[model samples]
Target: MESSFSYKQTVPSEWVDYNGHMNDAEYNRAFSLATDAFIDHIGLDAKGREQYQYTIFTLETHTCYLKEMHEGKEFEVVARVFDYDAKRIHLFLTMYNADGEVVSTLEEMLMGMDQDEGRPAPFPDLVAEKVEAEYKVNAGEDTPKQVGRTIGIRRK
Candidate 1:
């Protein structure tokens, strides 16, 4: 559980939407970049994929846009790992503007995969141990509601 990882990016012209703000797809791109950074921090990288045939596949995601972002604006993304199990990881990411205001938030759940077989697989012992250690350190640091929140309307 890294407290945070930072990434810098400039809004791309192609990412602009009809609303004149960064499009929804761009949010996913930023989140994906942040996820890669976190994975690299935990000893997983492209090289590891070739050697271990392990990778992560996103299972689900929820994002909230709180403010508008325009093309050519510089932004930063921060990511945190809030929870994980033998095969799954829960992550939270925040995008911020140069003024330090949050522009969006993304929540995602991912599962480990056997790249060779393209199937869900349990995390290796060494990788699981590292993730567990980080989970312990970051767990309970944030309220349960924040950690477990989902977007959209709830059905009765």
Candidate 2:
């Protein structure tokens, strides 16, 4: 029911790269943790997933790293539902540093999977409803500029 899902953590020293800031991989790691929290928001905890034999998979992801983060720095990842249907969700996750500035953002497409069949599947009715409700609350204004960017060098 809260507007969006959030996960917070401090950047461990191991996550830092030779450049002396957080590694690029750790930004994806933080967003991955945020997706776990988002799944819980839609009612698919470990018990529920086991009971329903359902799980979510990331179909694709686009990450834009806008700032640097050093070791031991605190950060928060916020997950928002850009859109969703019966089987898939377009999620936008943003990372904010301790001073509350946007440092990186990741946009991902996730699909529900039927574990037994090992294939994509629609979400359970309850989960679908919960996602729709959250989507309504999350798809408000001030959309992230990085939501749908493609990697390319703009020319001409």
- List residue ranges in candidate 1 displaced over 4 A: 1-4, 144-147, 150-156
The number of the candidate with the highest lDDT is 2
Give the alpha-carbon lDDT of every model. 0.79, 0.88
lDDT of 2: 0.88
Model 1 has how many clashing residue pairs? 1
Give lDDT tens digits, candidate 1, residues 115-155.
88889998877778777776775676654344566557988
State the lDDT of candidate 2 residue by residue for 1-156, as single tens digits.
135567889999999999999999988888888889889888899988998999999999999999999999899887778899999999888888988898998999999999999999999999999889878876567767887888889999
Give the least accurate 10-residue stretch of model 1, judged by summed lDDT.
Answer: 142-151
TM for candidate 2 is 0.94
Which parts of model 2 are misplaced by more than 4 Å?
none
